[model samples]
Target: MSIPHEIENYIKLQPESKRNDMLELHERILQNLPSCKLWFLDGKNEQGKLVSNPNIGYGSYLMKYADGTTKEFYRIGISANTTGISVYIMGIDDKNHLPQMYGKRIGKATVTGYCIKFKALKDINRDVLEQAIKDGAKPRF
Candidate 1:
């Protein structure tokens, strides 16, 4: 019903190992972005078909589209995937920025345009990951 309740329920539904990691990431995000707006998406498209994994979102920013329209979306997000977890750092204009800046330093994580996906918390450099999150959380407009 509530954003936090939904997030906690989602994380609790994860496997033990993943649950702990997800909880930790959730706390970390809250600590880093203390006043952020929280969100929970049940991974369905408008048609209610399962499209993506459930996402726990943080912060807020205005996103502008090429069509000269804008919408508010989360600045950072975390989700449990089939293999591991995905940390989404939305609003980066340069697709290459993340991979170039954090690909090598964030350990085994895959640094895409707006996501850092890893198998486990211990597999990556947490500090670099935090910095990346902070970088992405900066004002988007």
Candidate 2:
């Protein structure tokens, strides 16, 4: 399958050591959620200044704010960080869900409420990570 130009560029821009990891993770995510929506964020502010690492997002959900406003956003996001990579699991109401569910099983990764940070794919258990991603993608409160 052809990836969007923006997402392609995002992967291309990563360091050599990280490019393959990004691509593999991207493909793994697709395999887990075939035909899911794809999203790319350039990590720029309105003025075009870089603010965060570029993100490759998957799936969709309507995010409600306290002020009653809502916006559509991705349910899962993958991004390259200075040290390694991060997988963001959005929309989980219980902040402890991730750590409690997958912390010990996820290998060397750091499991936070909505983010899984790791140095490399080899450092983490892919099967466990996949499970977390799948569970995180589901709608829950």
Candidate 3:
């Protein structure tokens, strides 16, 4: 039905460990983003083929394409993956920003340019992750 309902359903479908972790992360990201937009992508392409893990998104941004088209998208996203959970910080100009800034300090996680992935919340520096989300949440207008 609604985006929030869909997000709750997606999180509930995860395994016990992942379910708990996703719930915590969902709340944390909301707290950081405040009254931002919400999104639920059901991991399917237009043909309904599975293209990725279902993800919950927060906030909003304009994604500019090379051909001069712009699309509104989420500023931050989270999803449950096969091995762990992935957090996406979108609309970054540089691909090395996240890794270079928080790779070593953010605990046992893989800090890519636009994503920070970890097996569980306990495996990362909660404060560091929150800071990253906060930084990413700023409207890239």
Best by lDDT: 1
Q: Rate the local accuracy (lDDT) of all candidates.
A: 0.93, 0.92, 0.91
lDDT tens string, model 1, 24-107? 999998998999999999999999999889999999888889999999989999999999999999988999999999999999
Which consecutive 10 residues in model 3 have the weakest lDDT in total? 132-141
Question: Compared to the true structure, candidate 1 yields what TM-score?
Answer: 0.96
Instruction: Give the distance in Å from residue 5's predicted Cα in candidate 1 to where it truly belongs.
Output: 0.3
Local lDDT at 15 for model 1: 97
Worst 10 residues of 1 by lDDT: 132-141
Candidate 2, 85-136: lDDT as tens digits? 9999999988999999999999999999999999999899999999999998
Assess the local accuracy of residue 77 in candidate 3 as a C-alpha lDDT between 0 and 100: 95
Deviation of model 2 at 138, angstroms: 1.3
Tens-place lDDT per residue, model 3, 52-117, is: 988899998999999999999899999899899999999989888889888899999999989999
Candidate 3's displacement at residue 111, Å, is 0.9
Q: What clash count does candidate 2 reach? A: 0
